[model samples]
Structures are given as C-alpha cells and as structure tokens.
Target chain A: MPTSSKIFISSVAQDAITHLRIGAFEELSRLGHDPQMFEKNFGPWPNFQTGVDHCLKKVSECDLYCLFIHTKGGSMTSNGYTVTHLEYLRAVSDSKMMMLYCESTIMDAYFKFRWIIAKYIEEFKLSQGRMPHNNEVVDFLEMESEKNPTSGIPSKHQIDTYVWVLLHDIVMVKGHYVEKLSWGHTVPWASYLSDLLQQGLQLLPKKSLYEESSQLALAFGDFTSFAKQVVSDHVRISELLEGRRLLNRSIRMLTRSEITAGPVNGSIGSVKACSAICLFHHEGNSLTVQYYAGDTNGNYDFEVGDPSSFVSYTYNNLQDGVPGLFYWESRRLFYLTYKLGEYVISYHFPEDTAWSSQLYADYTDDIINGILNTHANGMIIELLNSLIGGLQK
Target chain B: MSKKPTRLPAAQDGWHVQTTANALSPDKTVIAVNKQGTVLHMQRNGMSAIGKDTLLFVPTTRYTDNIIHHKHQRLNELNNTLTGLTVEG
Candidate 1:
C-alpha cells in the first residue's frame, strides 16, 4: 500500500518534465523514499494494445498514479492505445491509490498524444464534483514558468505544460515520492536513452517526414507513425542527396537486403528472405510466389509456380510465415540499372557484419539501399521534374 | 554739488538701435544699434522669441553648407543612443 517501497512515475516524453519531477521528487523522497524510476520514450505504448497492456500492468502495482495530462485534445487509434481512459477511472476508485495530475497545455504536435490521455485530464477541468487539486506536477510547472521567454520553437510552451501538470500531481495527491533504483537505468540503457531523447528531438522532424511518403520499407500499417517517419525521412533524404525526384516508378530497379546467405559478389550473401503475397486482376490467374532477401528492396518478380525462380523478387513471392506488419531490419540493395518497361531488379542481402564475403555484400547493399530507401515516390518526382523540366524548357 | 555724472547714458545715446520688438524677425538676430550697429549673440534652443514661443530662424542661407540628409536612420543604425564622440582636428 502506502508503505515505503520504491515506485516509478513514468512520462511518455522527458523534455523538462524529468527535472521538475526530480526536484519535487527529491523533496518527497526525503521522507524515506526508495527513489523514483522513470521510463522515457518507451510508452504509454506506441501501439494500441501494447499501450493498454503496458499501462494496465504498470498502473496495477504502483502506489501512486502520476498522470502527465497534456491537452493535445483527442485522437483515434486503430490499435487499443486510445480507447482506454478507464485506467484513470480505476485509479480514482481506489482509496489506497494516490492521484497526481500533470496538466499539459502546450499547443503543438504533442496535442495528439495529449488528447489521447484526455479522459483523465482532471487537473485541466473539474472532475466528478471535485475542485481541481494542486499537486506537485503543477507546483514545479508554475515555478518553472517564472523563467519563461517567449521565443524559438516555443519550447517554453512544452515546458509550461509539463511542469504544471507534474507539480499539480505531487501537491494534490500528497504523493510520497518513492526513490531507489530500477534496472531500467544501467549503462547502455541510460546512455542510449539520454542520447536518443536528445537526438530524437533533433531527429523527429526528419524522421517523421521520412515515414510519410508512401510506405517506403514499412510493413506495419502504422499510418500515423509512418507519416511521422516519412516526413522526417523526406527532410533527411533531400539533405543527404543533392538530386531531387530521386525515384521514377518507371525506372529499372534492382533490390536486395541483409537477410540471405552467400558471398554476394554477384552470387548470394548473408541476408534474410521474404515471400511475396499478391493477388490481382492483371492477367490470367497470376498466383505467383517470389523469394526475396531480408530487406524490402522493391525487387524480384516471381513467375507463378515456377520451379526455378530466377534473379528477381516480386510482391507475389511473400513467404508463408512473414506477417504483413513485420519489418525486416536488414540492409538491402536496389540498383536502378535500366529504365522504362524492361526494368530488371536484382536483390541481395548480407548475412552478417563480419569480414566475410557476406559482410561485403551487406556493406554494398547498404550503399545502394541507402540510396534506394531515400528515393521518393510521386510527389518528390513531380517536384524534381517540375524544377528540372522548367529548367529544360 | 557736481551732478553725479549720469553714468554715460551711452546706452540711450544716439545709436542705431535695432531690436526684435519692432524688427522684422523677432526670432532672428534682433540687432540693436547703440549709436552703432553690430551683431551680438544670445544662445537658446531656437533663434527668436515671440513673447513666450521660440521660433528657430532657418535662414534662406544655411548657417553651414555641410549637411546630412534627414531621411529616417536605417533600422540597425537607429539604436538606443547616438554616440557623440568626434575626433579632434
């Protein structure tokens, strides 16, 4: 129950919330706390069911419920992530469980996530005949508000939202901040996290851009996350390569990935392979399965029930077990050799990162796939074409 | 008793007296001639005084020919203060 056992207050994003929590948490911890544990970046769950399962499991055991309530408004989720505001309802029912609210009023991209957490955003609005309680989350936020300067990416907006809610949570819930360590903090984890979060802010714009343009190498139907990453990718590839309109669907493309076995000097290399699953009303019963490397290199053409499928792989060759949502994080190669209708795509994958022939293939695959993966679809082509075509004319 | 010699009524003595009280431009050199005419100086924010108001005498002939056009200073140039330092010739 409320005994002096250690507990964690997790926030989906750390921004300045970590510091506020640290300061307020320190004061509460002085009352014989076991130390607070924080999990950043990993969730309120990235997917629907995952988030629900995670929140359910984590909230079940915690003595306190510190909710960072941001106002991104509401959002829909195909997965179970958005529908479960019931956790807050459950937490409120328990007398033993203390409740803390971190009110978020930032107006930006996080609005979606903020709304995703809305039903429990009591600090912002009155709840069941209750005057909004001031908690630690609100306290820290208000204190930090004194340092506001209205400029830049409006980070102050986010800082304001995060701090207010955190302070509100602590002050109102009378949350006894439990301190102490959890295994989530060791070497690579901490370094990896701090580095990623710090980097993610810088990387997000580009990352999100990359995920937006038609599903590049994405297997999962995560339109939202894909949109974000594509947007980011679009920004990145444009910067990475000088040439725009990088891909023309009509151009010849060769593909390969880091998921098959062999030496890849034109033969095979170590890289995984995937089977194609395609059914269309093109020609006669075109029921053909193609074999491809680990990476989705947009190559290969499987000629139906052909016994010896040759050098190319097609969408019709998806393997038996590969799920539609699974992504093979393998390095692949897509070499655009020819143009127009006679397009030939040779795909390859590297087996390992070692110094063997397979590794060489993966390395080479990285080089080509790096370019291929950066290739844009229609819009990019149109942009490049218009710019160039205008010049040409 | 010798009349205490009136301190030479030099001021009212025959002199070409010119004062803005009757002169053309009161705000400008209201030269008064005391039996002689010459220009004297009285410093003020402006040139002539009409009772209480001061009107600056912007002569048809400039006090000096060197001038800087008074279009508004550029954004960067017009800062809080204008430094008044000048190099000694």
Candidate 2:
C-alpha cells in the first residue's frame, strides 16, 4: 500500500497563485500525503548553501513535482534564470514526474505575440535593407506606440518577452501535457487545483516491497548479484509474513495468556510480558530485545534475550509503575536508531512568539501523563499479585 | 485675351482622362470626349485614364480603399496561418 508520499509544489511567489498554492498544500495533507513547499516546510538553511540550492535539493527528494505558470516568470536567480525556471529544469533533469499548468489567456497572447514579432521582423528587413535586431524591433514598437497610442498594437508590458521564451521551451517538449487554467474573477481556482492534485496522486505508482528492500541493501553495501538474490529472498519471506496476519496472531497470543492467568492479580503482568514477546516475535531475527528491571534507588537488572527467543524489559528509577513509560520511550529511540539507520539527531526550538510554544508544551504534557497512568496501573496490579501470592502460600 | 482654354467634356464610364497622352495607342484603346470636353482612354490593362487620373475600371471603388481592404484581408489570413502552425505549442 502507498502511504504518505512527498510532493513538491513549484511556482512563483506571486499574489495571483497564493490561494492555489495553499489549496494544494491543504488538499494533499487531507489526502494523507506530505506536501513540501519552501514557505511551509523549509527551516533555516545552513550558511554554505543558498536558497536555490536548498530548493533544488527538495525537488530531487520529492516523488512528484508540480509547476504553476501565470503571467510573471518570477524573480531571477544569480544565473539570470527565474527561480521557477531553474526548478523546472531541475525537475526535468532528475526525470521527476511533473504536472504543468498555465493560464489560458497567457497562452492565447503568446501565439498572437509570436505572429506579430514575425511580421515586424519582415517589415523591418524590407525597409532597412538588413534584419533588425530584437532590441531594435522592440524600440521601434515602443516609438510607434508613442507616436500613435491608439494603434491597437499590444505593448511589451502586455505580454512579457520571457513568457514567450519559457512557453516555447515548455510547449515544444513532446509527450508532456500542459493543462490550461482559465482566468476569471469567478473561477474556483482553489477547488480546481485540489481536484487536479488528487487526480495526480491517483496516477502515482505504488512502491513495492522488493524496491524498498533493494534501497535498504544499496544503502548498506555494494549491491552485487549475491546481494540482489538475498534482497529478493527477503522480500519473498516478508510477503509470506503479512502484517495483518502477524497482528492477529499477536492478539490471539495475548488472549490465551490472559485466560491462563484468570482471576489472578498477575494477569496484567502476564499481558505485558506476552505483548513484549509478540512484538519481538514479529520482528524476527532482525532485532535483539533487551529487558531492564530497576527500582527507584537506581538498582537495576538487565537481560538480553537470544535471537531465537527475543525478550526485553525496562524500568526507570523514577516513580513506581512508570516502567512502561520508559519502555515506550526506549522503543521509540531504538526504532529511530537501528530501524531507520540514522545516528545524528538535531533539535531546534523556536522562540516563543505566539501559541506554538504553549501548544507544544501542552501536547507533550498530555502524552507523558497518559503513558504514566496506563503503565502505573499495570505495575500496581503486578505488585498486588506478588502480595496475594505470598499470602496464599 | 488667352483665347479661352479649350473646355473639354467629361469622360464616359469605361474611359479615364489623361492630360499626358504621350503613351496612348488607338489600336488597343477606345477613346471618348464627354460633354465636359475631357479626353479619356481605356487601356488594354483594364486601367482607364482620364486627364491624369488612373483608376481601375472594373472595380469602381477608390484605389486607396481597395488597397487597404486587400492588405487587411491578407493580414487576417497570415494571422490564422501562423496561429494554426504554432497552436500545438
């Protein structure tokens, strides 16, 4: 199944398309995909890289790249190309999937403008005995417009020269479709954009298990023929161990453990232990589970299970019954570390300017308190089981 | 007394008057003298000359207006052709 995919939105930061950009962002997020735009997702850049470099890097990372072109070509970069143009080139060179859209009125003007320029060139050549340079023709048109303001000839300002240049390149490319967006005061641009993006998402190909395993293999070492065979075998085995089946089996194991400990105060401890066993069983030989038991005074017990029978336990030296909270945190760290294969971690907290800081604090407090209460009740139940067993014996 | 300039009559429908009659030929032309006493000639090329005025005898409209309309028609044709050629782009 395809989970969330990363989509990059490329366009000029003009007022005309501001609503369209935001609409795309919200719609992609609503459809459960990650929509990356510099305005929303980009944090502070490192000193060595410029904004253009950062943008290109993001374009390369995204699964799909969408470009919106309207009247303006956008601000030029140091290399004299507009930012949107460079982004488009990057997307092309990377062979990234693209969705192109242009304003319909601009397209109409482009054709007429080309015809007028051709005519002007022919007329100038006839009168001047030599072909006029582009700038000369532009100057002539300007002078003519000033001389006869009502000549009905469109000025340079009406349709930008660069727009024609960009459109020539984009439209000349074969096999790519350019959708025309009609311009009007009453047009529902936001909803129209959202529908287009949803359609694009539907056409995306789902990543297969073999492909994912191959990526993992390539990341680790040289992907030789032997590695290829191993990856193929791993994918086959993984397919056999379907996720839903594994989850059902885990639930059945927990139910059986609960029945065996019926009416005993140890039922909660049995359930926790069984849950840990099921988690490790599903992981197979890929991960090694560790068990930690400790008291508030910092005295601790640690056990590492063998590959065939992986088991782990953790108890913090904080309040009693808080062991599950510590366990959950450790599990998250382990998954991020070994499963994701990322060693470096960076954190940046923005200065309090509004409700962001307060919101973060409140969310963290609620999660930690909830985890503590759930685990603390289980620990108390275990303790009761111990006392009752002693009294009965 | 200047002997009163020879007052000529107007030219007929198919003929135009030309004061410089040096290029006139009688074999391939039909000449006329209207009541206004203006000498007129119709030429082989379908152009009629009256005194110094040259006009198309077939299309009775003014020469300048005809040229302007023709030019505008050609421009519209060119616009459509160019538009059709590049519309795919």
Candidate 3:
C-alpha cells in the first residue's frame, strides 16, 4: 500500500477561510498525503450536476475525512441540509475515518446558545401549545441577539443556527467529539490549521510494506480461488466465450478506426498499468507504464518505461474474436491480452529471473481472475440471455 | 400581599448582582441589577452590558475592574491573532 492517503477536507466555502483552506491543502501536500478541498478539487462540474452530489461523492471516495467547523453552516442542498452537513453524513455512513476541528469561540457560543434555545423552546411551548419550528427558533435567536448585542452570544448572521444544530448532532454521535486541542483561537489560523492536519495525519493507521503486500496477496488468492471455481463450469465458459465473440465483433464493426489507447498514471504501484484505451474516441492517446521493485528495506523503486517498450505485440487476432494470452518460452515473457469494445489491449510481464515460480504463477493467475470476474461476468450474463432466448425460438 | 424582592449581593455602588446557572460555567452566573431595579447581563468582554430580558443570563463571576480589564486584554489578543484574515461581511 502507498504511504499517502486521500484526505478530503470539508468546510464552508466562504472567502473568509480561503486562506485557511489553502493552508490546509499546502500542509497536507507537504506531509505527502493528497488533500481534496473544494477550492482545489471541486468543479468545473457539469451543468446538470449538483454541488452537494459532487462533494458527497468526494467524501465517500476519501480514505479519511477532515472537517473544519467555523461559524457558517453554508448553503442548504435540495435535501434541506447544508452541503457540509450532507458531506459529514456521507462520511459517517461510509465509515470514513474522521478528524474534526472547530473554532473555539464559535463552539463555546454554540453550547451556550443551545442551552438558551432549550429554555426558549420550553417557554414557547407553554404559551403557544406547540413546538416551535426550526425557522422560528432561528428567528427568535436573531431577535434576541439583535436586542442584546453585548450578550456574548453569536447572532444568527454571525453564526448560522444550523451550525449550532450540526454541532449538537455531531456531539451526540459516539466517539466523535471534537477534542479540546482541536479548538483554538490563540494562534494564526494558518499555522493552527497546519498543526491540526499534521496531528491528524499522524493518527491515521500505518501499515508496513511487508504486511500490506501480504494482505494484498491474500485477497488476490481468495478472489482467484473463487473465480477459478466459476470458470471451471463448461456451460458458463462456453456462454462467456460466445458473448465475447459477439461483443468483440459488434465493437470492431462500429468503432474500428476510432479506438485509441493511453496510460493513466497514479502515485501508487497498484494503479500503474500499461494501457487504458478509450474505445470509442481518439481523445486520449499517450500511454505510460511504471514498474515497481522492492528492496530489502521494504521500499519500492519505481521504474517508468515507455509504453512502446512494454507493448511488444499489437496483433489484430480478429479470427479468434477474443484476444488470446501468449507465453513466449524463449524470452520468458507472458503477454496477457483482452478486448474492450474495438480495442485489443495486451499487458506484458517480463520475466524477473529472481522471482520464485510460485510468485510468478500467483501474479498471472490474479490478473486473469480479475478480468474473468468483472468484465467477463457482465458480458456473459447479457449475451447468454439473448443467446438462450434465440435458441428457444 | 406582595412577597419581598429577593435581596442579592451588591455589585458596585448602586448595582445588585443576580447569579444564575449558565451553560458556559454552571457554577457561576453573574448579572448586574441597577439601583432602578433594571437587570443587565454583562458581556463576555466585560466592557458593556445589555438588558437581561433580551438574553439568557450571561455567566461571569463578581464583576470587578481587574477582571473586566483582563477580559478586554484577551479579546484584544484574539483580535490581533486574526488581524490579517478577511472578516466576513
């Protein structure tokens, strides 16, 4: 596993805290973890996409969620919850690890304000014979704050009543209390934010390279075993092969000239692959490949190779309809091939003479299993249904 | 027959102190009642007061000149800490 985790920072998108948000992004980047913040990572969203949906999707994808709570609760979404509130809820439901920080004065005022609201609610209920609506409560606070400007309580404009409600809900969640140290007003916000991020990164789970490799191997082994069982059924195999042929033919006829390929680069070794081809268009064409070699100290040395060097063969192999895997005995290289739409892509693993035969076998099996389990399964189900229906007629 | 008004601790020359439990400090609650029997809650900065009827009883200890000065000093430090940051309109 890679040392850096994707950390999503959640906060109100207010200009007042732009510097603080940027400071967090810079600090988290300096510490080597990828930080996702709205100012840095969000939008240029599609016209149809809601900002809340994009933010919630990001919150779900992150390995860790960090929220900076200040006075503002931000604009409400279609769901009648603020964007930050929805993001926080998504993080909670997804069980993403969380780090929460709040401005000390605002948090202090929130508790006092909550107490005041409780009393006011009781008084309102006695007089009116019904519970006050959320808006009414907010209006009451606004009136009270305006009248008693020196009360030390935050006005509705200064701190949204929704923020107080959010804080109340956050506190009620088990083991999710904002630590006293996490609340600060004594230092500059930028420095304070950096320190908090540093502390948060330190608290994340750390795995040794060996342990992570072992875990990955174990997962691959389990999946491969299950896939092998599924592939052994002759009927299923025949159905899958037939489906692949039909899909391959259709794609080739539809998009033979338009298909293009490229590499998608990533910081981690797991995502460093030879080719990711866009089947229907020629938009993305540059391909890059990276190889990882482990040393005695459990560190990986990354070797970036040209795409052409890694891809030695580019055969059409249209006769088979499905791309075939070729093992060159003399060179000890394995070329694993698969077809996606009109593109026939091949990934070659050059023989590492030092690697044990068992390790080599396991690695090859894992790739084959992954392809068969995902792509093959989906295509087989769809095509098999059509084939079966035709045969019945 | 009207019950006699509860006598509270005298805060200054003409102000009487009324204490109530608050969220900030449960044990301490200090508001000042003037000679005219008008109640006012002292602000957190201790520099000013507002009508007690307009807010939940604000918490403080006995209002003294030294404590008020200290509150002002802390507020100044907090303001100085955030001097360069953009204040929300």
Taking chain B only, the TM-score of every model is 0.16, 0.29, 0.23
Give the worst 10-residue stretch by lDDT in candidate 3 chain A: A260-269
Query: What TM-score would every model get versus the actual structure?
Result: 0.19, 0.34, 0.36
Residue range A5-42, candidate 2, lDDT tens digits: 67898888878888888888887787677898979997
The CAPRI category of model 3 is incorrect
What is model 2's native contact fraction? Answer: 0.00
Candidate 1 wrong stretches, greater than 4 Å: A1-11, A24-30, A34-51, A71-87, A93-96, A102-393, B1-89
Across B2-88, the per-residue lDDT of candidate 3 in tens digits comes to 022211112121111111112222322323334343444443334134332221122211111222223334544544443432312
Q: Write the per-residue lDDT of candidate 1 for residues A1-393, one digit (tens) a residue.
A: 455633345444444445555654564466554434444322445464665456555555555554433432122245322222334434544422333333423422232332122223433443345534323323433443444432221244444343323332332233222221222221122342345347546855665454443233232223433443444344433231322112322222323233221111122222322122111111243322222233344343444443222222222333321111111222222222111111222223232322221122223333333323332321222232233222222
- Fill in the DockQ of model 2: 0.00
Among all windows of ten consecutive residues in candidate 1 chain A, which has the lowest summed lDDT?
A320-329
Q: How many residue pairs collide in each prediction? A: 95, 20, 0
Q: Of the pair 1 and 3, which is ahead by lDDT? A: 3
Ranking, lDDT, top scorer first: 3, 2, 1
User: Over the full model, what C-alpha lDDT does candidate 3 score relative to the true structure?
Assistant: 0.46
Higher lDDT: candidate 1 or 2? 2
Best prediction by TM-score: 3
**Alpha carbon lDDT at A241, candidate 2:** 36
